[model samples]
Target chain A: MTEQELVQRAREGDELAFAQLVTDNEKRIYNLCRRLTGNPDDGAELAQEAFLNAWRGLGKFHGESSFATWLYRLASNACIDFLRREKRRRSLSMTVSLDDEEEGRQAELPDQGAGPEERLERAEDRRAIARALEQVSPEHRQVLVMRELSGLSYAEISQVLGLEEGTVKSRIARARAALRKRLLAEGNFFGGASSTR
Target chain B: MCDCEKALDWISLDLDGALTPQERRELEDHLAVCPGCAALARELAALHRVLPELEEEVPEGFQQAVMERVRAEKVQALPAGRGRAVPWRRWLSLAAVCAVVLAGAGSLGRFWDRSGGTEPAAGETLPVQAAQAGAAAQAGAAPQEEAAPQKEAAGEGQGPELRLYTAMADPSGAREAADSGEVLPEASPLPTVGAAMNQAAAQNEDLTEAQRAALTANCAAWLQTSGLDPAEAGLLTVEAVTQTDLEAAVCPGEDQRARLDLDDYRVTLGSSDVLLCDSATLEVLGYLPTV
Candidate 1:
């Protein structure tokens, strides 16, 4: 069956169907959770929890968007709730070590031939993104994660967030703008610089 | 719309492909003449082009994690007794057992002391001793030694904790014997993931249609030779048992268990559960997970 169909079945209280859905989506869900939570253990917990949550709430699913979008929205909401609770419980962003940054570094490279300076610039760009992302509001950061990292479309974003299509478009625009501003301010991008591409 | 805001609006709607044909024409017309608006449009377009491809920072399991947390809350809202909701007959039987036990001793005997009653009388010692024996039976082989240090370790990683998947299949022969259907058994991987090898099988589409047919033939041959079920899962061996096995091995005392009902294949391993062969064989083209 299709993932969406499996998801719909899962919503209807089909445990086996939902389990299949979780299996299908586990890695992406785990990676996304890892990025958002920045801890392996917490990510694991949250990823599994998201599956269980999806299974139970599957009946309420309206099939309005891709199942992944709906599922991620649910998970994103959960992560946000966790973050808020952590903020209340302890005024920290649940300090994960620089280990996650190290992993990000590992992912920064592409296989194409580039000069040393180009590599440096790319690394710098990623670092700039990492720092700038931390500064954005959680909502803004989430929009970036959904649109950029997850590569979701505007309609998908709207469905995931329960936002109007126009609102999703605007927020995404602002989020991109905000990211650009952050990177530029950090000098990660050359202001008025000529195109490297 | 204001000229400045117009550029922003166009930039925003552009990626979504939401700009009407007329709007696109109007915007392109504006850009053709207005150098400033054009530069700004180019800039926004550049940002738009870059961001999605730029690979924004995510913690780990970005989408999966979010969906998981969402799924967890929704699951929690359901009766926590999710899959294990005992049938009505079982519940009634349990209730009857409790009622009978209570009825058998509803009296002024010294052993009748449940909470704020007087001290236990001489005769009550036997009942207390019986209760202690029952408790001891539950702790037969496992000692208190294993619990103390483990509990401390669990206490250390406390956060917005929720019971995820647990991997506490009894480490006995029965687990192996159950669902030991006839798939080819390759050499086991390091750390011995026992039954989690189904994941690799699920991934790695090198086993194309002919290969699957060959595998099915091989399985049928092996099963016929060795008296195995063709549909049976023969043996599972995972590369990294660390992910699925270790945690569940540690947490045997968990109050809640979220059983992962692996598709077709039973979730013999905790984290490494697979969508079984019956769902997607060479017979069925596979479905990709949400990336």
Candidate 2:
């Protein structure tokens, strides 16, 4: 059946149809979450939450936008909310240390070393990119994830976010600039090559 | 160099495949003379290429795990229907505790009168009481004897007092029970509670659009004081309240006394805080933070 047919069934509380929808969108949504959060675990949880929210709110989906676009909006909102809560939680908890996050991130990097020096450098570069993405504002991260990671066209992003196409265009531009600024600040721009004017 | 601002926009557009050929040519023309713009374009293009490569494999069994949670949520949502099927036992225990508070509602009424509290209008407390009683009856507890005196107290110009009683008891139980397809008393407290809320919402229509605007502004301002962006407050729900008891439940350490002239309003600021503001003034009264 077409996705719209599945969506219609899911709206009527058909779990099988909803599961089919979930199966279809799971990988893309998960990658979107991962890019937004810069953490695989958070990405996984947020992706699950996005699908669950979609299931619960299925009744409200009136086919105004494609199911995929609606799903993207939900996933983006979930990641943004999670990011905000994490910020608040971090502010509230005095015992949380920056070192803990660093240690956790280091553990996440692969230990396999086919070419010890090059592989380690590549891993460091990947970490720099992830860290730079994380440092950007959540709104910036959101548009960037949709555009770059999810391969959503500018028009699709506008529909997903309910922003004007002009707004999405400017936001994507600013997001890229913000990300570039972060990489430059950390001296990780151009894959650690020497900075050029 | 001065036109680099437009050039940067075009460069970003070019990276996204959004620029038309004309715009792309204009961007290239600008880039040829502007080293700064050229470098920025190259870096952003390179970043764009790297970003798509950052896509990670979805974890194993991810879809299955999500399906399991969805099924669990479906089970939990069943029979009682949406937003209503709470663990009724917890509400029953809360009802048991409120039953004691109801015993002293007479004195509480007097305290509000003596303290010059804004007692809600007559017949207002009946619905909330009906709600509590409905919850009690739903739990198979005989609350008739306990409900009788509170009705009399509510009759005696103790509108805010009894609603406060209901708030302390269970403001939500009545509405949820009313919405659920359960056998309830014809004058089921939950229905009365639901009707009263609906009536209140209906009355909201009677407010001139100006009044609604003022209420929204007051809510947004109060949310600002409670550490929320006023811009996002438009998305949060705002409601009028005579008492902050339920609001207090959501916002602990909220000073009820700071309420303006015995009345306050509430704004749900995400899942963390319910901000209470004075009904007449923009003064922020109290907030309940998530424990």
TM-score of chain B of each: 0.26, 0.28
Candidate 2: regions farther than 4 A off:
A92-123, A191-197, B77-291
Superposed by TM-score, candidate 1 places the C-alpha of residue B13 at a distance from the truth, in angstroms, of 2.1
Per-residue lDDT of model 2, residues B37-118, tens digit only = 8888888887886676556667889989997776545323111222222223222222222222333333344323332222
Candidate 2, CAPRI quality class derived from DockQ: incorrect
Off by over 4 Å in 1: A8-16, A27-44, A59-66, A89-113, A191-197, B28-43, B53-291
lDDT per residue (tens digit) for residues B207-255 in model 1 = 1223323323433453355433334332221111122332233211232
Q: DockQ of all candidates, in order?
A: 0.13, 0.22
Classified by CAPRI criteria, candidate 1 counts as: incorrect
For all predictions in the order shown, the interface RMSD in Å is 10.5, 8.6
RMSD (CA, Å), each prediction:
19.2, 19.0
| Residue B155 miss distance in model 1 (angstroms) | 40
